[model samples]
Target: MMLQFEGVVATGSAALDSGIGHTALKTLNDVTYLYSVTGPGGGIAVWKLVEGALPQLQDTEYFSGTITFQVGGIGMPATLAGDDQLVLDVRTATGLIGYDLNPDGTVGPLQETGTLTGGGDISALVQFGDILTIAHESTGQIATYTVNGDGTLSLSASIAGQADSMQVLQAGADHFVIAADATTGTISTYNVDQNTGALTVVDNSDALATLGIASPTAVEVVQAYGQSWVVVAGAGSNSLSVMELAGDGRLIPTDHVLDSLHTRFETVQDLAVIESDGHVFVVAGGGDDGVSLFTLTPGGQLVHQDSFADTIHSGLQNVETLSVAHVGDELQILVGAQQDEGLTQLSVSIADLGIVRDGFGTVTGTAQNDMLSGSILETTLMGGAGDDILNAGIGATTMHGGAGADIFVMQYGSDPTTINGFQAGTDRLDLFDYPLLRTPGQLMFIATEQGAQIKFLDEVIVINSSTGGPLTSAEVFGAGFGGPDHIPVDFGDFGGLEPGSSDGVQGTVTVASEAANPGLSDAEIRFTPDGGGTISVRADDEGRFDLGLPSGTFEGELEIIKTYSTASYEITALDALQVLRMSVGLDPTWGPATPENLIAADITRDGMVNALDALAILQIAVGLPTAHEAEWVFLDDDTDLSGITENNVSYETGVDVTVVDNVISTDMTSILLGNLEPV
Candidate 1:
């Protein structure tokens, strides 16, 4: 299945005039409600979606009299207590407001359930089961409240702490909470009693102090690879940190930190995780970078994927919050930016979440000739007792051909699929979107470390087998042709010719210079064969040319001629360093100095000859200590008197002249002292 982008929907005047700060999702029966809180106007907005082929927006409600001060957080309980009656809780500056959301997308009058002591400001709230927790920034405390049967909250317990953001997650039957202290730049962990609604501090000392966490604004928990990981976003430090939940319910840093430069995680405000099938991704929104995507590894590590700034849509500066939900089969990402007035809706495939599952449960085929298709998610298809046709779209899949001979169709770009208990002699592999049989000499069956690779040009299908066994041509058919004419053929007969023809060498020719010279364009590249024949080509505007030559182990002379000067060189592995030196206007012999040759020393390619270019050439010539042994031999050329010279001077002056040979030679001192010791 594919996810196509739908247009963004405005949350009416309440959200546009006051700005949207937070959002939550609630699905009841056939309707899905998107609840959002306004920033300054202290209003609530609800958008309804009717589940259908594609979930469609049904209605919108804007209630400005929900709270007094700006709303900080909003959440719903894990489960509804009454019949289709949901309770939505909103956290205001000094108190918590509870609203009863009816099935028709309308809410009752707002009720002030509980208030924080000392006039503390509520920053965030999260609910697990019937227990709700609120982060009070001013009082530096985390207060717990019990959800009453009448949709009201009663204060149960309070844990002294300084936190601006908090998240509650459940692993198995155990519950845990992670809170972020923006003031002290640390994160605190707590274990929750599932029965009594109490929190116990796991670490008395600041646990995240060693990480140098600063101004952490958001925290999230994601389950991946059979493990639970907590990801924290630091707005002050402009970084993201990952931690794994230990068996004892404590948080352990993974030492994997993504800084601002690599992730563009600037002024990170909020983070959200979306799990589709078995793949999981973390999306963070902040600053001018917009929203950033990251994949969670099985080991609880975060890998940066992409940024939406330049790739998706621009002008999303100061993006504040992000929410992701699976509406119908597609996952929708809602982005709320501070400067941007409205929310931006983006739709992406569930497969894009990076989850690679076995499949979406088991799909059984009917009797007689039946056809079944799978999504781009991991799924299993069973051809139950019939000559059934199975089509597993792009995702990794496992197919079971039960009973009758089955025809499994494969598509290009599809993930590796396995057919268990294969009746190879009877079943057939139908190739779709790929014309492997029609394209002669394009398919290759070669042995790999994993097993064998069936290559169709640049694409490959891996077959897990230790021995390099050949696949029958009849087993695989080209697109659209599935008949007796498609007979079994040998995999060896289709081995294509080598690239650039079977008997030739191909290389690129580029102009070498100390500084970039636009005038070097259209230079003449002449190759004189050792057999007395010459081929010439003109360099493009970029001073590059593709050179192709007949297959032969012979030395050839190359000449590059421009308007200023001409350079004559040989095409040999030993001359590679000399060729590079010539390109930068440096004489390989260090015998003569010329103005035109010095022009080529702009190895930095900044369009000007400078000392930096000479230094670059010297470094390459004197090869590093870890260089290949053969490279050391090249530097041992003692007959070449072109020893280390000062400032491109060809004459040997009173300056100490050490004949540098190898890496350990005393002459190496001169090379290290900014003298040109030829390698």
Candidate 2:
């Protein structure tokens, strides 16, 4: 269907609408649309999708300011390539604003045409095959511009002619036409060369076909009634001029010359064609302020169809240019208001007219890791609608939900959950580490519910305690899985053969006592502290201590001790110190004595049988480490006593008394009885 245009319409914040230049509007092959507009700010307002609901267009990313090339004023429209692109020329005090649009409809840099007055403006947009045509109203000439691959434009050909407004329709590979209506309230048509944009005036052209078309400002037409024609909108009488084309391409009068469509308060500036099907279409718009439709029969006559003009608010707004775009099966009308920054869009869906979509495909829903109860691998998850639960491992990842009732899942750490949020499929949230599970004060406690029981799951080690959910203490839980128990130290040899901590060696010692009491529990005894050599004594069924060390020579006195503690009980009493000493040949450097070396009672060196030697022994033998005592001795055999008178001992009644004299022991060492020696 051909579009019925209402040109560039805008709304919302007035400040945001400031620099939007939306003048280069046109239709191609009559479908797939193209137009350009400036940003309210640095970018333009785009209407896009959220979660597949009805779309809302609001002002968004923007850039350039002000429309300088005069595209919307008494101007014609043009599109380059196919629907590949379109161009809008701006009119400014400095120079005209010229913009090249991408096929996808984005505004690029504006070019200045180098018009010396710095005041030239562009009117009309026309496309003939690969070339795009623009008419400079100031120069009254036609310029055919070429479309480059990178979406830039350069002039290919120029032809001088006073252009009021130009329109081009396909004639041949390189042929086109331009109609320049005059400021003197007249209309003229020219057959154009597409290869050069050169003008050839047609012979049958009537200079002022409609006498009252005072401001023959804009003209539009599409083929009907076996020929191409023109609908010229005028300012003075508000008349519509119907111009017919001769075989050579000149504007001739139709059966009816001038038809008064509407008495206007302003010059009419918009026009359009609406197709009902592929073949039939209605010519409409460009009048005092209403939309009227017309259709042609097989005969060469123009027939009027119904008008939606009554639906329009009479004087509330004025529309200058109109373009229609089909979004799917729906038709949207865009009207550009010249006098005021006014825009109105009216849309209607053809499917709403009793059409059904059977094979119409679908609008897919997103599926992601958005569940509430279980663990999920982020890499395996797809984004979709609905709440979800996720169990995560150690990593950084994204979770998204596309639509209603959506849930996002993330496993926090070994112990907990970290983040939860809701948004569209593209929304992203970051999960930080769950650090609180590491605090020191959190302890594990076992509580048994009334009828509840506590036990290590794997161990079957039962606990008889009260239970609850998992009583505070803020404990993290795991499925019961326990490890091994460790062996402990025993008595006696628990701390084995370690040397005396003081002198670092086995010393002169005395044995106090010895006992072999192994510790309560039989521990696997082992050497103590690795570097020190070892001592080992096994612990009995009842833990006890049994330890001793051999004595050395220097007084060798030491206390051998043992401490015993009952299993799970503390040691309370101890009889631990036992001392032992050795006195036989204790010194390796000294010898035994008879007389000369005897430090005891044998004190006389004369080898005597007399009391004088006994008296010397008595004096010193009574005192030891120092022999200072006088005449008081611990006796040897009590040989001399002052008070004794035959009471201590008695010999026979008849006693023989003999006297012996001692010799020097080396000179004559024999002692003899007289009778026994002579025999």
Error of 1 at 635 (Å): 48
The per-residue C-alpha lDDT of model 1 at residue 170 equals: 69
Best by TM-score: 1
Candidate 1, 354-381: lDDT as tens digits:
2132224466665544455444445677
Alpha-carbon RMSD to native, per candidate: 20.5, 47.8
Alpha-carbon deviation at 443 in model 1, angstroms: 32
Model 2 lDDT at residue 576: 6
Q: Which residue runs of candidate 1 sit more than 4 Å off their true CA positions?
A: 1-6, 12-18, 49-95, 114-121, 150-152, 204-207, 259-264, 310-315, 351-679
lDDT of 1 at 36: 61
Q: Which candidate leads the pack in lDDT?
A: 1
How far residue 24's Cα lies from its native spot in candidate 2, in Å, is: 5.5
Question: Which ranges of candidate 2 are over 4 A from the true structure?
Answer: 1-10, 15-86, 92-104, 108-120, 145-159, 171-174, 207-212, 224-226, 255-267, 276-287, 298-300, 310-316, 325-331, 338-341, 346-679
